[model samples]
Target: MSAAEELEAGGAPTNFDAMVKDMVRLALSSEYARVPIRRADISNKVLGERGSKQFKVVFEQAQRELKRRFGMEMVELPAREKLTITQRRAAQKTEKPSTSSKSWVLSTTLPQAYRIPSILSPAKAPSSKAESTYTALYSFAIAVISLNGGSLAEQKLERYLARMNVDTQTPLGKTDKFLQRVCKEGYLVRTREVDGGEEIIEYTVGPRGKVEVGSGSVAGLVREVYGFGQEIGDSDLEDDGEGGIRPTQVEQSVKKDFEMRLRRTLGMQPLRDRRAADANGVDAGAGAGADENEGRRRSSRRPAAQSESDESD
Candidate 1:
């Protein structure tokens, strides 16, 4: 009789081919496509009772049919290693802990047959050439901002450049130009204000800068060229207003001291470019002052010509 007919007639399924197919389907449908078919469970499921001579015979026949038809023989699952509380603690102490300790525990407890994909792997280094002066400057600026937790004061940046001996010939002018280009090109966001009669400019990573840094491309390039790894832990920075972290007090102090040394040794002064000052509305008339003065002088001379023409007339 067919398996279905035998089931409907209140008898255990005796069709070896049908029984093997059912068991294979059940196994494949289970988690990891492998089911533990215990003898008691099988007896209960197939015969609706445990310990039946006829059920045992049928189960053996099904196993043989499965091996013959599908070349898949049922094998016993390996015994799991059980550890006592003391043993578990000892094992945990021996294992090197990581940030993903919880995940490590879950991975250890997972079935041996099931494999979990690795979380940490060596990142492929970005394919990049030796950057030009502008590219290098851009990369350095972005890297500094990233190292400082994504935002930096303009004074701090200038100090960093001076200390690094960047553009030793004209550090002030070069730094100004670099900042302008990066800000204009959407690689950095420059916010300027006048504080106590001094123009203050602050920089933050722009969209492009964030993308490069977040993808580890900028860090990779920095590592390759500067031999300095730019990676920073998330916990190191304080939360800033712009959804990014700010540099620590120690970092700020170091930069401040370096800036002082640069000032004393190299005479690095904070440049106040007229155009930049005007752009920030700090000194709106800075650029036009000379032009306005020249216009006034010409206007003063123009009245004399007008008087000469009147006298001639």
Candidate 2:
């Protein structure tokens, strides 16, 4: 503490505040004393037990300086208080993250326009009966494929949605509708299961579906088996470099014309999985045969040694 400051304070015992005042003066005197606030330095470790509260003081002082120098307020949000899709969509219309105290949004601008013409126009209304039928059929398709380990099932789907805290039942129905429309327009081929009791149908990803779903430049089953890049149009689809687009789109962007153009060139023929299973079986058999032959050779060798010993005796 400064002697002058002590005298001004009527000789009150010197405290850390006086020390901070001195440091501030020194910092002001030296241009090299200025430094960007390192987030790590403000952590508890560097601050020490008694000094733990020092960061808060430094932070407040920095905040005061910033406000004074720029005439602006600093805004920060906790991780969980981040943005939502609907909120993001609404914000994007103005080309800005929402300044609402309730919203802490992130923004991304698109580099190109790959808009398909039909998706831009309003879709024709289908009869309710047709919608229900399509929904049921597609749901069945999803369930069946998922049951065979082709994709995630109901349980996984529910868990995923819950983690994201997204309950878009109406939007989910739209996904079913989009899948159904693909099934209708694309050259989907159905084949009987190897067991013959029921058929397992695999939908071939056509060219239109490729443009709609696949992240790659090529079309067909590759896209269905693989996936597309992120940031299609204005929103983000979960791209795992595989076909399952994440955070399913609320609207179907690929039109019937594009969907129809995709040819069903794969997944219709009988699956060749049996070849893999057969090869595995053959390898197991070869190993077993070698073990058995080795045992027989050892037994024969033992008998020959016994005979030779008996002759020597």
Compute each candidate's TM-score over C-alphas.
0.28, 0.19
Compose the digit string of candidate 1's lDDT tens values, residues 62-103. Answer: 545544554333433222222234445765886653322110
Give candidate 2 regions above 4 Å deviation.
1-168, 171-179, 187-192, 196-198, 217-313
Clashing pairs in 1: none
TM-score of predicted structure 2: 0.19
Looking at model 2, which ten-residue stretch has the lowest summed lDDT? 103-112
Candidate 2 positional error at 132, Å:
18
The candidate scoring highest on TM-score is: 1
Report the lDDT tens digits of candidate 2 across residue range 72-144: 2222211121233444566568765544332111111111131222222222235444444433333344333
- Candidate 1 displacement at residue 119 in angstroms: 30
Candidate 1 lDDT at 38 equals: 53
